[model samples]
Target: MKKIAVILSGSGVFDGAEIHESVLALHAVEKAGATWHCFAPNVEQLHVVNHLTGEATEESRNVLVEAARIARGIIEDVAKLNVDDFDALLVPGGFGAAKNLTDFAINGAECSINADVAAACRAFKDAKKPAGYLCIAPVIIPMVYPESVKGTIGNDDGTAAGFNGLGGQHVDCPVDDIVFDEENNVLSTPAYMLANSISGAASGIEKLVTKLVALA
Candidate 1:
């Protein structure tokens, strides 16, 4: 059986991982006949947000602890992720991917990735293992891959420019499609970046997961 490593930012769409995207990706992985293990950085979130009100709150939270909520408490620290044990990697997105995973939400193209997160991702790249990145999570792709590595995040102009500025070639993909960098063994989908509904997001996610497992 193929084993996949899934990295999460947190449990919510406002400040963490997109609940729908994360769950959909996980389900797709299993449906593809692959198993998944979740991981998160052991660090504090950039800030907390009240999803209902769409407002920032003064509450403090740990990335791993909050991400566990999505993983059902069956996750490990990203620092402990050994690429040799897994066939592929998958990172679902939300604001947390930009805010927490790489600070792309705040710093855009100038953002730096968390050391542990960078290490794990680079491990997969170095080993030539296939990896799938969803939604805003593609912001981390250029940092992990070589110059001009291809990816997508729907068709947001500002976000697309940032991706290009970061040395990645951003492809304008549709909600139900994906862009695969065959040479780099990387794949990306718009997911919630373009989808207005869960079913819309599922179409691309399912395809990406199935392709990721097949490549693995």
Candidate 2:
């Protein structure tokens, strides 16, 4: 079985935007019959504020852990178990993860870079293991493997400008279609617009998953 590490932002608050892609990715991986491990940044508290009422809420308290701790746990789990044990790294898109880090960093972007995560990603690339990213998750790819080719699918006309800045080739298409490079690496989606098109996104995800499993 090919093992994959699924990375997620530790924000317990389930914003409609964040949960959709993550859940979809999870579903796709499972449907493909691949093994996966879940990873999340740790926070002492996760707050959820009501948009209308402005009331602040927090998740249940537990032993407080910092982002570094959680990231370390990911590394430890990967290492102790062996990197070759896993076939690839999977990152899910969410606001909290994107906000705090340029590419999975913590502490308002000023924190020490998590070289471990970067190293793991590099290892995957060097090994030719298939990597998967959805939505904003692709933002982490350029940071980790700048030389890798990438393609974006869906109507990101306005957002495509920003992606071009990252040196990614943006293809104008519906998010439902799968976009890929010649090597068949999975790429970005029109996640910003395709939130309601669950069926479309699922089809795209299925295509990506099929390609990735073939690589493995």
Candidate 3:
């Protein structure tokens, strides 16, 4: 069985909606007959602030603390394992992963810009092991390959502007629709949306895992 790593942001909500993308992706991976591992950063607990108001409130703090605890636990478990044990790395999208100061977001950035994560990703690529990402998780690609020959993919508005600071073309299909280049160097998909449904998310995951296994 191919071993895979799935990364999730600890935050449960993003843009007023709960992030069920990662959970659904997990289910799909299992169905694909791959061994799955979960990773979340255990960054320092932070107080949640309203993106619109920028106000600090008790409710926000509590919520963030809880998220951090969960993210930390996941990361701790993954970090203990040898990366060589896994055939590929999978990153599932959620608000927590996209938001800064959290595990998913922080680690995603690291994997994108940091030399270590980049090296690891490159190694995985060289091995022909399939790496999977859904929803906003594709953001890591641009971060890692800012000026590569590969094109971007996601929920962008055609002009490549999507999410808070990310840019890519808006895809009409489910997040499981994997877009890639001839070299298989670039993989893109849409997993999360502003007005998303749980059923859609679940369906997307099933497609994503199936596509990934086929690609592998």
Top candidate by lDDT: 1
Give residue 81's error in model 1 in angstroms.
Answer: 0.1
* Model 2 alpha-carbon miss at residue 211, Å: 2.1
> RMSD of each candidate?
0.5, 5.5, 5.6
Give one digit per residue, the lDDT tens place, for model 2 in 62-148: 211322233344333222334577887676555434442233223322223234445666677677777776665555555555543
lDDT of 3 by residue, 16-122 (tens): 11346655666677788876766544343244546557564465333333433433444433334356778767766655445532233444323333233345455
**TM-score to true structure, per model:** 0.99, 0.69, 0.67
Show how many residue pairs clash in every candidate, following the order shown.
0, 0, 5
- Which digits, one per residue and each the tens of the lDDT, describe model 1 over residues 79-101? 99999999999999999999999
Instruction: Give the worst 10-residue stretch by lDDT in candidate 1.
Output: 100-109
Candidate 1 off by > 4 Å: none
Number of the top TM-score candidate: 1
Candidate 2 minimal-lDDT segment of 10 residues: 104-113
Task: For residue 15, give model 1's deviation from the true position in Å.
Answer: 0.5
Q: List pairs with backbone clashes in candidate 1.
A: none
Better of 1 and 3 by lDDT: 1
Cα displacement (Å) at residue 204, model 3: 2.5
